[model samples]
Target: MNENLRCADEARTASVVELAQELIRRPSRGGIDPYGPVLGVLEEWLDARELPHRRLRDAAGAPVGLLVEVPGGRPGPWWTLDACLDTAPYGDETAWTFPPACGDVADGRLRGRGAADSKLAAAMFCHIAADLAPRAHELAGGLAVLLDVDEHTGGFGGARAYLADPHAARPAGVMIGYPGIDEVVVGGRGLWRATITVHAPSGHSGSRSTTVGAVTRGAHLVRLLDAADLPGGDDGSGFPLPPKLTVTAFHGGQGFSATPDRVDIHVDIRTTPGFDAHAAETLVREAVTALDTALPAPLPTAVTPVAAWPPFRLAEDAQPAAALLGAAAKAGLTVRAKTAGPSNIGNLLAGEGIPATAGFGVPYEGLHGIDERAHLAELPQVYAVYQRAVLELLGR
Candidate 1:
């Protein structure tokens, strides 16, 4: 490894550790507004480094994005490294071994909510750009770092807003800093969030023969859904894509004494590459319609889509994918390309014709769960791999 590059890696690791702590200190739960201090700290760091950056804002004037651009001397492709600023709510803080925001460096690990999920990647990207600045004039392309504020809920607003900006230059390719060690993730699963509402006329429970209970109808629908089998496979190799359905929330009934007139079942559907949200919704609606026919009293049913994220798959032969493999090898890291289990902003970028991948950050387990943490020692290696990946994609 180059000595200067090694030094830059070490500095990046330490900086990300500190930055992760700073981000965790702010309660930037999804849907909740991000704390200004967190954005200010990141901006201040960029400004001090003399990096040209812009704050992407929404109509409400909320800070939705942070973009830093590293210009290249020669005209060429622009590459983007993106990370989300928002994190899931800290559940059961008492379950944590240390405070989520302590930014504590203990036993060669940094423990926090956003530590591994994305904040570490965001900080590391910044450091990598700074280190590459000395050689910017020799590089073949420009690099941009995009820090999005809304990812935990869905990246639709934050990501779409940035991509739609008239002044924003669309990069030839994008590398998303999700958690995946030095491995390149070339594909991701799709997401469909919808609510199945069952409705019936309210009546006395004693007269069950005349009145149809909404809760009962909802239960039937759930059973039908649970019993329904979607397409999936169990390829014993690794990370085989599987279809999943979950009832995240359910509510109905106004009072204990009355038969509930309405019941709502929130459904979360994860589909493979070939599945479309419209088709999935249609299947569910068909199931509900069939259930209504069998009921004693007719019950109205509807499937309402709350959000949809399409699945994305990039061919292994694509230039960006090939470049990632080559870069990882050059950086002395063994790499494999795979699909992500959950939906990510990579889906959006891939849809836009920018062959994108996720998992350019430090590897960590237990994401969105208690005891979330990232390996402190491995981040430098990840940074090196990403640095090489960017150079390879830009043909430097």
Candidate 2:
């Protein structure tokens, strides 16, 4: 068990670190983004290594993602390792102490936009594949490394597109490299988005006979939703997950004088397993309809479903989770597991019934905020966890 997965010595470690820095230097917004200088650099690196892979493309011939495969000498299920390629936009240049795209390694940190949110782990996975390629015969199964875009913007188009690609490997299990180094996230909250549109006859604010103003009524509905006792209320008797409801956007009244006739209130709700997106929508519509009884005159209201995605949860007995926990125990690292928050890709996989999926990676802070950073020295430990997890899950 002491067989170290930190196979990269000083020079190799330096090389991987350098590659990660170079990747951070390039800016990739998302799948729809036309600018992808990072992809070119990655392609060159893969070419030099002569790795077997494919560029997943959309119908219009645009690159959505890259899937690299290393086949094992023996037969076993394929394990898909993922780290998103697209990094969130660096908010303000002046806010950053170190230049966001400089990819500087200073103050004991790899400082850049994607330094933690995950270009580092992506680099580590590529290097791991290089290390494992020559020793493929020793592995009991094959491996596919997926570096994707379309995660940050919540489209998850990269994963969806790649899943449809005929050449893409159908992963028997999956691993995502995210921030929390000392944690292995087991699942995430689900999301439901909808708009409540109100249609009422317009009138002058001074002479309106309307009992409930459009904006005021919308506000009232917001309070109702917030106060409603939804399931998964941290009771500890259930799943220990809480429901989330928020009025993201409210539009009504123009020029601030005339009594507004139409109003639209947009809401984004997060749900747990017992309370799903569909269930949330139903409850909201029913409550909205019930509000009519309290009104002096019924104002027609419509609740339109914008979009929805179910939450993802992996059972404790799932193979990928077991492999990760076992490796962590062997490494003597205390790692906690829980469902963190809202996610798109994990939900997609979980909805599709893919339970053998888990997430773990190097620690970092300020995700989607200023001055994001992660420790290069910690890469070896985390890499060891990934390598061990892979071997434990895919090798046997």
For each candidate in the order shown, give its overall lDDT on alpha carbons. 0.76, 0.76
TM-score of 1: 0.90
Error of 2 at 210 (Å): 4.2
Provide the global lDDT of candidate 1 against the true structure.
0.76
Q: What TM-scores do the predictions have?
A: 0.90, 0.90
Give the alpha carbon lDDT tens digit for every residue of 1-396 in model 2.
Answer: 333534436556777778889988887756335535777777789889988877777677777777889988887888888888888887887988878778888877888888887788888888888878888888867988988866787766667776787766577877888867677877888788899986556677777474567777677777777777776566342455787888898898998557777789898988777778878988888768765545423456888887787777676668788888778778878887777676657777777666544467777876778898988766777877888888876664
Give the per-residue Cα lDDT of candidate 2 at 351.
70
Q: Give the clashing pairs for model 2.
A: none
List, residue by residue over 215-331, the lDDT tens digit for candidate 1. 888888888888776766853323368767788888997656789888999998886655567767766887788778877445568788887767777766775677667667776
Q: List the residue pairs that clash in candidate 1.
A: none
What residue runs in model 2 are displaced by over 4 Å at the alpha carbon? 1-7, 31-35, 203-212, 232-238, 295-299, 356-358
Worst 10 residues of 1 by lDDT: 231-240
Per-residue lDDT of 319 in model 1: 57
